[model samples]
Target chain A: MTTPAMMYVHDWRAWQPGRRDTSQPRLSVAEKPAGGHVPAMLRRRLTGIGRALCDMLAELDVDADCPLLYASRHGDGERTLEMLDSLAEEAPLSPARFGLSVHNAIPGVYSIGRGNRRTQQAIAASGDEFAALLVEARGYLAQGEPAVIVAFAEQAIPARFTAHFTTPVDTAAVALRVSLTPAQDAWALTPRPLTSDDTAESRPQPSDLIDWLCGIRDELHCHRPRQAWSLVRAE
Target chain B: MTSELEQELKHLIIDTLELEDVTPEDIDPDEPLFVEGLGLDSIDALELGLALQKRYGIKLEADSDETRHHFRNLRTLAALVEERRTA
Candidate 1:
């Protein structure tokens, strides 16, 4: 089976330098905090996970009324940590933090901020975040109209939850606009079984996958069918 | 502070605000009660207003400026409740 579709990929770091690369005729969104030499508006909006989603959606050229799909590997870790810390200290949890702690709060906040009624937030802790997100996005594509997907993953883990995994990296967010319109620039999705002796315990890390995707300057093939999908990075 | 009013307000705040780790006695009266005070926001204010209106038959006027002034603190909210109760 083949899924032929047009997709635009954006990297938060590349868009930091404030030079517009109009190679793909698409808008770009990045997560750059203050003092990062990036544009002030971009820096201001992409503050936290929920804010990042909202900012990214705001930057897209898609019709404001179109549906959105937001996927995250780990959603709202800072808020989770804060809640856990409050519980440990026996202090009252901030109601705002409590509301932002939910995994779907990113999408909910974006919906509220944009006044859009159609949005879905998907959180997949499993190794195949991109694959799961693709499946979800495909459902939107099935509607025969354009849909936007904003997928982000950050690296800051709370010390209280350190025992859960092993990885140290910074944050990254990517927003892609996908439509049913067939275009010359598109990536093909193909699934294949694993022949290597790679067990579930030895899966590729999120940072590693992100790095590989970001480094692609030309046509590249991603082999991990269950966990991998290719993006034609907008130049 | 009337015991019944205090108790009812505490329960309503706890339930409406979803203060999972707090009980009625934990909320000290006369304490500053927004953000750094109680960490509540405009959304919580609307929610609490709705719950209070539904439960006590009191209506918070839709004027944003008026609602902000009325929801300044628990004391103000309590005073409004007292007024509505008497009226």
Candidate 2:
């Protein structure tokens, strides 16, 4: 049996930034606030990933000062595609879009908004993003952080790139509350090799792992093209 | 400090930029428009150029250093528009 890590799962929350208002044109500016911690002024300036991140963070009610790990397969989905379109057309890219299209823009904005100067990491690892997120959280806990908020958000793959990429139809965010509390259920992580060639078990986004942690399965295995992680839930 | 042309330019900046929570009166005519003043970035400059063309029938040269000077502030923008306005 792999030694169970001391990290405890406190609370988890998920949010869909703009599932409603389907009337809005796709791949354009996002809709108004569907409810989140972000102020109105900031909301107007947020990309889809940023909006989803702030929304789930508000729901989780974690301290702004807690170390944060933001993971995403595609950091700023729509904005990135838009930038590409501008490049093809030989038009000047929007400075605002170019500035916020970076992988860490969401968390960078969050830290600036709350004035939290703690170390915040932004991660992007193709299929093993969830495993990477948890692993980073564990590292923070080992470094003496009382708690860690692992937030993940991603937008749908742009239509032009759908032929080459795999992504969900909507934008979603999930916040996992990983703490050092000894009372709650815990999970053990171990590196394992794939005995089978089944790649279907791998999840594309971080929110999918929430179901496994929510007791949907006692043991879940995550596989990436290069790595595999075994997560065992405690009874 | 609040001339009629400056007030119009301020209104144009606010409307074109979609700057939320900011009013025309909040913009100082002499303050820098891009960096330390209204915090508008390069993208805003493009959008503002287009909006100015549509409203004042004036064309901003993409490669002209004078265009950058005219976009420095509301006062400078108004003067450029006043010098170029045909109607």
Candidate 3:
């Protein structure tokens, strides 16, 4: 039997390079890399994907003590590529780039921006990133965390590594505040088994995915190499 | 040393660290650049060292007090650049 919704979504925001904030007036890409939360010192050093993630974060009104979960299929690809290139050239690697190339780098920066020291986790499960993140959320809610902020993003692979990836990697970032007992309608995840008709690689682009998250879409099913789950809108 | 070299060093520091709000004039040569004046942390120290190495071909004694002395401020950094730069 499908279990009850393990968690609820309180609020969410999804960001793209040229996308506009419907809540605010027109803001150019140049104008929206970071909001007032990120200081100039930190903002100046953000990569493009980092910028998108930070911009999405600024829209979230999370508590100072709220836990955070950052999930990405490929984390910090550009910075990792730069460090690799530096190593190949036998040159000293940029310390900043090296430090930011780690999986939890952007979330660490966000913690600094918000002075948040709550329990934080970063996940990089191959194709089931979001699903696995929700599983973590379910754990947090089960353990009595009032809420958890979920941040997910993926950027285009660097030119040298583009040929390694078969699918067109779309750049996007999404932030969501999930709680156990939310004021709004809650969502549930039902574990599913993969089928021959599985459309894993051919999933909708990020923009459409964001729209699906916002609106009432059909059951969103995602399958990894070894596992699968269906996100259902349980009313 | 000429003021021009010190000014160049200031610009280098600002650019390398991505200190968006600070201008060369804002950084006092005598003030501590770490933890007090410019408020740079340990990561900034390593980043600055790497930038100096890339731009000037200068190698730092990674754990030496002498290296720390050279990174004292703008004047000290420029002095190291003047003495050690190959490019």
Candidate 4:
């Protein structure tokens, strides 16, 4: 079941710095993403990736019970790195930061705040997360659910890794709700696996994925370590 | 009247927990810090404990009744700091 059925894009939101698209309605998440409904206590714990995802998810007006698929290339790396640094220094680590140092911690905290009881999956599939999320979301849609929310977030990399960033929109997120029924746009996908030699070590950025979802691209090619997909606009 | 140490503890609580819009004048010395007046949770309790250890070199036994009593309110917490603080 590599290929999912024809998928429809219901709604989407993208946030980044210096993105002034006059065509769309203005949102307050231009530079700093406010964890819209997240309370102050929990909101302070959100990293840059969590901030973008939270803002986009809240703006989409998604139901609390809806399944969530959070995809990130680097998941909570800051928290992990900070703990590593603390251990290296023989210093005490803050218990709160330790609790939020997992790939799923942001969403886990989110579920607690909203009291949401739904299947939530967090993925760290390098650059292949876009395609990976599509497959997971497609499976959720196949289950007869009206829609599922798919979010891709990338935190700002350190200065040493700035040379590795391919897109200007490195610290940003794009979230979309998808279903089986036709909507403003749709995607016809032919999913295929990529060999280890071709692009296994690639950390392809999410800027292209953002463009493709915003209808800026009629067709797009995406590559992941395990799978690649030829995505064509179906509608 | 709140003691001078209690005033310091209120500021520390706000700064450490990142409690927005709360001020030293707003926190009552006798009010509970968790599940009540301030509505702080267990995580906040752990965070405040760490902050106290780092700032004043005072540590508490984990989940002990004595620890819970000392952490009951800002007034009691300040009392613990006043008695145990080494730095």
Instruction: Tell me each candidate's TM-score.
Output: 0.56, 0.71, 0.84, 0.85
- Model 3 reproduces a share of the real contacts of 0.88
**lDDT, candidates in the order shown:** 0.56, 0.70, 0.74, 0.75
The two-chain DockQ for each candidate, comma-separated, is: 0.05, 0.30, 0.82, 0.66
- Pairs with backbone N, CA or C atoms under 3 Å apart (clashes), candidate 2: none
Tens-place lDDT digits, model 2, residues A109-212? 77766666788899988657877887788888988888888887666787888988754545667777788666535444445667675475665464455445
Cα deviation at A174, candidate 4, in Å, is 1.1
TM-score of chain B of each: 0.79, 0.93, 0.91, 0.96
Stretches of candidate 3 exceeding 4 Å from the true structure: A1-3, A20-32, A58-61, A185-208, A216-219, A224-235
Interface RMSD for each predicted structure: 11.9, 3.7, 1.1, 1.5
How good is the docking of model 2, by CAPRI class? acceptable
How well docked is model 4, in DockQ terms? 0.66
RMSD of 2: 8.1
Candidate 1: which pairs clash?
A: none
Instruction: Give model 2's DockQ, 2 decimals.
Output: 0.30
For model 4, what is the error of residue A38's alpha carbon versus the real structure, in angstroms, after optimal superposition? Answer: 1.4
lDDT tens digits by residue: candidate 2, B30-86: 889987887786767877886777788788986589999999888889889889985
**Candidate 1 vs candidate 3: which has greater TM-score?**
3
User: Which is the leading candidate under DockQ?
Assistant: 3
Q: Candidate 4 lDDT, tens digit per residue, A1-235?
A: 5675457766777766555553655233466666767877678777655666666776664467778898887776567777898999999888888888878887787777676788899998756888788879988888888878887777667665467665443666777777787744554455555555455434445556565655677656556544368999998
